[model samples]
Target: MSLAERPDLMTTDPVTWDGGMGSVGDYIALLKPRVMSLVIFTAFVGMMLAPGSIHPVLAAVALLCIAIGAGASGALNMWYDADIDRVMSRTAKRPIPAGKITPSEALAFGMTLSVGSVVLLGLLVNWFAGAFLAFTIFFYAVVYTMWLKRSTPQNIVIGGAAGAFPPMIGWAAVTGGVSLESFILFLIIFMWTPPHFWALALFKSGDYRAAGIPMLPVVAGEDATRTQILLYSLVLVPIAVSPWFLGFAGVTYGIASAVLGAGFLGLALQVYRLRTGEAARKAAVRLFSYSILYLFLLFALLLGESLVTRMI
Candidate 1:
């Protein structure tokens, strides 16, 4: 049966079919928890690196707000992008596209979570954080999902700012304002996004092409995308070291940043050098996988250095 004919399939409660069964977990999968985990981790790192300390309970509350906001963004994105998503292989099985969740329900869920997270953060934590969280929702759901994704080749470039906001929000939760330090954190993620996503685009061009999305690989072609990746990776190395130059981090972070930056550039260069379809795809996948590790390790090192300096 077509998706619209079986509205009952979208409900969260258990459904017994000719095949087997489904439950609440399907709806949770719709929220994109794996993506939320990364949001929480980066925000946590930002909070930790911020100048002041938040109480443990308050910190937990802040993190919860961030997670809820991230999930809200994801839900709304799914709601709006369902049509295109159904056409794309990578996204065809998502809850909305799979007919496991209705667009209206996802919209309601996202709206409720967005409002709840912002209000709770304002009441329990701080308004600056609340405001940032609210903006993040709007930027992702409206700016990126509704407008940018369908319109521009630079969609990921501009849309990346939405993902880059969590660290600043986390910093604001503790400090009640933005600062150069938080901005450096922001810049790091911003610069890192193009290379990371373009790597994925290189290997997944078919999915993007099917969705009619103008990703770098679709518009600029593989060779140009590879060149852009190399250029962006080169620029990122210096930006990654800016935390040390700006005095937000110590020499340890500077050293780690240099090493990580070199590793990232090396991968990008490999991707550029290996121009054959199979080799490029392998390099792209390797770079995509390593990029996640690279960001997490960069932040972890920063947090560790902060802790050690405090102890000393």
Candidate 2:
């Protein structure tokens, strides 16, 4: 429903829509900066791994546009999810939910950034990359947040595409197209997302349940979520290791991927086995934490190897 149509959301009570100035930090908070950081890192790795080099200035611009697009997606998500964000403990402090920023303000901020980023990227970089970035924003803000997240347990499973597109977009920014190597990068993150999020869902099932989010654990039960985590981890490891086998990465990355993949599976196994009490929660938290590091290290390794190869 439109903000114009929802009286409760349009109140000038400061907590809802005061039409007052929010601090700069409140505006930044609407962007979900942590998630934007991951999007930036992965997209940079994709750029570095692409076959051709871009002018460093253009590359930086591309990354900036990507970061803005990601931030826009986050703001829109926060705006739309505000109602439920108020209920969930984890998100209750978000700018909109915490009364730091109004929903109308956030919507305007997101829409402006979303349009500006795509247009600038298209004009300054490449249209292909611009188009992909636009789709990523739409997928996250509309497809995942507006639809899947509220309606199905497979939310993360399908919505993961939004997060997984950055590398491909980055690759397109440099090469003006996609390739097998880029898709491998995409696939690695895509497969990793389910296990990563389901682990968080395992521990935060209560929060999801309270918020009516329909996360896998909240909808399917913990045992089923654990099983899915393990199953996805099994697929993720091989895909994470694939760039090495596919000739894009060197032996160092291969060894590191194998080691990292082992650690991932080990944590996932613990999450799967410890299904009750504090032990289970701890296991889930561990898996969730490690999953972040796992993806970062994988991309960091790929970026490092590509840079070294270029120098040699």
Candidate 3:
């Protein structure tokens, strides 16, 4: 049985500083910068696509607050999950588990940024955006990390709403309200997250199982997880393509979405079919990697069209 399955053997020692304070890099690593970058990009796309305009300075500030809020959520997650982090090979070297930063310090850092970001965004921009940003942080840090992550196989499904809110917050930053167009953007990410994360969980099932993460693959088995990945992918593609048909996007976006979406579906299908051995692992890895590119390109196309339309 996995260490996680043998809970009696699991260590609960208090995590403390090793010898000295962490370096700047170690501190930043606590923020999960890779994830933060994605949040910033997605939020920026939402801000850009909003119908109305925001002052350039306010727009930059909104993005900054959103980024900081996202980083804060990451830090909090690392803090709370440090116990599991130490057990999972993939996460073993995270700042907290590596003893580069104390859990209390990480918690303080995260909370400070979380409150500060929401307050600054509200005061400097619109409260609607600020409120949504606050909720996003709370959802990721509290709802997802603290609650759902360890407790349910449906964790990623329910927790994805947190990530989906960034675009809506960006839209509210400009228009001070959400419309169906903005919600569609939100829906695209929400639907895409399950398959994307599940693909990662497939190859990393061992890591998740060892850490007791209860990822779908760990709880439901690989075949079940693969089936769910394909189902989510099928639903995700059309929702991803909808912004184009809904008239918010143009033909260029429509064509790009359709083509990119075909590639996404093709990979998802491959993951579904390749059911065992190294081929299965490779397929899951490909889908995981492609999902990142697919989402980026889909949003990039929309951003490009928005900019070109503005220019013309």
Better by TM-score, candidate 3 or 1: 3
Off by over 4 Å in 3: 1-20
Candidate 3 positional error at 126, Å: 1.2
User: Highest TM-score: which candidate?
Assistant: 2
Backbone N/Cα/C clashes per model: 0, 0, 0
User: lDDT of all the models against the reference?
Assistant: 0.89, 0.94, 0.92
In terms of lDDT, the best-performing candidate is 2
**Residue clash pairs of candidate 3:** none
Per-candidate TM equals 0.91, 0.94, 0.93
RMSD of 3: 7.0
- Ranking 2 against 3 by lDDT, winner: 2
> In candidate 3, what are the lDDT values of residues 97-116, reduced to their tens digit?
88888898899999999999
TM-score for candidate 1, please give it. 0.91
lDDT of 2 by residue, 43-114 (tens): 999999999789999999999999999999999999999999999889898888888788999999999999
Global Cα RMSD, each model: 5.2, 3.9, 7.0
The order by descending lDDT is 2, 3, 1
* Superposed Cα deviation of residue 297, candidate 1 (Å): 0.6
